[model samples]
Target: MQLSIYSDKNYLPKGMEPVPMLYPFWTEFIPSEKYPWSRLYGKYLEISNSLFKMTSLQEADLVVMPINWRVIRGESWRSKINKEVESLSIEFAEKVANSGKELIIFFAGDCCVEEIPVKNATVFRMAVYRSKRKQNDIIMPSFTEDFVKEYLGGQMSLRHKSEKPVVGFCGLAVKDSWEKKLKTVLFHGAMLTKSLELGVSPYKGQILRSQALEVLAESPSLVNTNFIIKDKTVFLNTQDVEQRQKARAEYVKNIVESDYILSCRGSANYSIRLYEILSCGRIPIFIDTDCVLPDESIIDWKKYCVWIDEKEIPHIAEKVAEFHDNISDQEFLDLQHECRKLWKSRLSAEGFYTNFHHHFSRK
Candidate 1:
């Protein structure tokens, strides 16, 4: 199905092809109008003044909107200023939905995309690594489900499971300062330096994505770190930090070689890796400080996994040793089996995508 994504010219779905994109984020790294299935904003949809002007909505089957992906620069809860950008985008989305074309928003699982009114649109969430919404419009089409199915059951369709543990992240890296109203950016290098000071170099803390791949590619014993802070309620990733692509690569490689992966998060938001790890067939060592999941969620969690208190991290080495010696191979495989079953029933990519596809088609 041709999905026309209406996002800034810079927000290209990396490696996303075949799915048609009507607009692109204008950026240097991403070539505009040159790539197939993606194009400049002017080529299809146009948005300004809380309005959207477009001619192709009638013919298009669906609209994949990366809406609310840019709220980082515009609002702060403590600041007097409201989230102007989010307000504008929400308005624009309403218009598109009212146009009779089913709009599918690529909302972050953990962001405020929920603020947008869905009167007519069917919001579809694609979690790269983490999702924040307690109840997303739907949770299918997860890379977890796709990854398992592709390797386990061969299909001829264009879609296949995404590679496990991609180095993608969704969180705030910077925020608009309250005093200056000027956005303060976090540099990646700064965060890495801080991680080093903590004596847990990000390079060593549960490495993922590219790092995990390398580790898995080499062996199944790579150590990767997961990060989560108690609910600050911001959607942007840790900011003002400089992105060192090489370091990220090395980090992911480390995880790829390890048998266990770290799944960490804070306050109401679980680590995005929870879904990723279960789907990828890796043992996840969950780090939870105090939050206890519900009986159903807990049964589900225990049916396939392990959990440790955040405070125990200091003694993680001993804990790891204990678990290694005590856990039976059958127990481990049972965890994998239940985890995969949960993924299929509750978090498969195909299930959600099909719902999204049908929703758009009906309208």
Candidate 2:
């Protein structure tokens, strides 16, 4: 039942910003600013690996590691990651082959999804991508449905395919252009402005659970991005980015005051907000490409919510209006219901762990 999750302090972010009040979880512990394991454990899973040691995966039922420079820290990032990968080489993957233990990697970005030749380790990618296909044999988890169900209560009972004209967005979306000092805000602002014109309810905030809940309440439709991530210290290596706390509050307040939320993939990983939106009892208006969704055979995005092509973002209002006309409140509710069921079965940590256990148990 125990697992090892590798990450560092930036797992949540630091300073002038307000994050979820995640603390005192028996299983949670922040190893260092360079690695944040505290954000994953406690009621989730108790972590016990210090450095990226082969023994960790060899010893535990499963070892979950993030293969990214973001989590790696310092100029030594690439080398450290490769060193660890080499340690878990084919020879290592084989040692734990029959140990009833497994190794799961948190890989969803463009940076580390490339194929790394390793011997014995089993790599599970969180989001789908071409690099994932080349780098490792992808292992899809079973947390999707269950995660949706638990967080989304009554909404899970409704049909979302044809819900009301409500729209909303979950998670964070800071354009960062408003920062007077970080002069590049103008460019980032342009991107945000483009997204807004595309039909996303504009809100200023970081990705916090309550804010996510609030965003959905505002509009029946929702918009999501990678919750938008950057180094706590941006390009200049200073935590000068404006605090998203104000934005979070404003979004929640607006959710209580508005109608639809929009969820879209921001910079990296498909924003978890897609589920969080459904969890809040609203439909997700997702815009993405074939690269990020789960297997098409198992997931029908149109069946649950409106889907727009990544390139078609400017037509967001048109798409939203079209989707709304096609479905009724009952259907929308059903879609929401289906959303919750999907998250519960596939997105939760417990479900992930269970799958990890099964992967090693075989043979």
Candidate 3:
């Protein structure tokens, strides 16, 4: 389908030359030359350039307007950018509607439904970082780094099946404190309030790491690193770069060799390890945190991964054992292959946009 991008000249980055409207917004916060997949941003640009078929505004099937949500300066600067994006969204939505074409406002930051215009347009968000008080239009949640293209390079080989099931997890395990307790209570209480409103229990909590550790301790066939809970909260141990790299290497090795890896939420509700596990063709013991995954309407997540609710943390070992016992050796191998295929086709960014275009075009 022919697509047009709408953006004001001043909304772009200061030094960068004019390019596609979505490129800078999407790759604003991504580090340069850090991870192997950091180049995926350029890959995304190539995919968008080919798929969108950039055309004149008057002769296009879809118009994409990117919202600038990255706070480069401070709160005042963020507010200013938000206002500009809001105004631009309204104007572009009206123009696209008048021209009888679809419009999609791509919000490049965390969930802020208020910034989204309540008009004839679809809103695409990078993260569902907040709870929605009410449903507003068709807001699609997409993540920046959820896909696995070439993170492992030549190391992407099929893992051999082991005699005993091996469950693994390696990450920061935060220590419990008054601060953490308060945050947990507040977050879960808000979720509970929202669940009460929707008449459904999502069973979300902040104690995912601790719970996973407990389950791993009880499991007989498991390999795990000794996670010492620190007094202060640490997402990734960055004090010593070499040690951090070593930890990451060990983490990858364990996950790749093991039959299953524990996928639990970190600070965010969603887990990046889930996608990594899928990319490795290993089953993920997913600890659900009321997460809204991309393309959930199209992707049946339960079929490929072992889903465990937050409330069912106590039975995690039992559930994993049951799942392991039920499947035959051949079935297990098939599942591994199936998981890889799922990532290559449905979870990756290229696959996501390809399917997204097809699905929306038909609709």
Candidate 4:
């Protein structure tokens, strides 16, 4: 089915595309010849240009809020939206509401505003708790570059079944400093004061990550672990170009070399690494913390990953070993290929938007 979209040009943020979330579709990028991460964000998949038609408001199926909700500059736990942008958004929403149309708002970052002021809008967010998910709040997948196709030139690093599965992780697990730990404590405390409906966790993402890694690492007989744990979240924060590139290469290498990549939530409620693991045609040992994934209704996400609940974290190693022992070597390889295909068809930036219109139609 074809979907037509419309957005008020006046509401779009200055120097930004009409639909920033679908950047690769309308914008041209100069290929980065140097760093691997530099080449990571652009043009991983090419889709038919006719999937979505940009049209006039009266002819459009959906109204888009050209203002990117996630890009508004804000402070940690206290970011404020731009007054001018806010006024324009409300004005645009009022117009759409009067026209009797539903607005599609894209919020892509780790942290989103506590709420969107508009009522007749569908908010797609990357970091949302399944329990707290509203009818209009659709849990969207974190867009990722295709590692196997983009980095490996379409050559998948498929693994054969062995006595033990190789589980890997390379990112922030523990808080690096006392200051950070204190901040986590303050944040956790603040969350406790909020409504229980928010799905607040006493343990921060880093603490939970460290606990899972420690449990897996402790059980050497059950699984073979290949971890590069760091105290600080360096991949995004590191300003050094050389260091960032090296970290990116290592992160990709860890996923490719392992059969099962430990995918857990970072600062956000969802894990970007989970998508990366799928992009590389590897199984993810997904640790579910009352999380919702994109297109969960259509996709049997359990088939792609070794699903683990938050309470089952301590038994992660045994779970991995059991999952590995059950699948035949050929089944294992087939799963890897299926994962890559899933990402290419539904999880990639181009792929998601190509099939995303059906999501609204079902509503």
- What's the CA RMSD of model 1 in angstroms? 13.0
Worst 10 residues of 2 by lDDT: 16-25
- The per-prediction CA RMSD against the true structure, in angstroms, equals 13.0, 11.1, 5.8, 3.4
Tens-digit lDDT string for candidate 2 (1-363): 333432223323232111111122212433444212332332233322221122343344454333322232212112233344344333434444555554444433322333444444555544444433543445343222222223324233332342335454433344434462243344345445534212121222222222333343443343222222332313224343455444434444333222345665533335455654544445566655434454444467577666766566555655776776766666655665566555544444433434444444442
TM-score of each: 0.41, 0.51, 0.72, 0.89
Ranking by lDDT: 4, 3, 2, 1
Q: How well does candidate 3 match the true structure in TM-score terms?
A: 0.72
Can you write out model 3's per-residue Cα lDDT over 23-138, one digit (the tens) per residue? 54445534555553443345555667656655567766666654343332112211333454445446656766788777765543322333443466665553353355233233
Best by TM-score: 4
Best candidate (score: lDDT): 4
Error of 2 at 351 (Å): 3.6
Give the per-residue lDDT digits (tens) of candidate 1, residues 1-363: 434434333233344321222232233343455532232122232322122222355665555554333232222222222355446556657766677765665443333222444455554433222333344343323243233333435321121122222222222122123422221112234434433221112221222222322322343232223322222323234342344443333333333334555565421133555665555455566665333332232245654555566556554444544565566666655555666556544444333332333443433
> Residue by residue across 114-228, what tens digits does model 4's lDDT show?
5767786898887677766788888777777668766687788878888889999998887346776677677665545642124343236677788889999999989999999
- Better by TM-score, candidate 3 or 2: 3
The true-versus-predicted C-alpha distance at residue 168 of model 2, in Å, is: 3.1
Cα lDDT of candidate 2 equals 0.41
Query: Which pairs clash inside model 4?
Result: 75-79
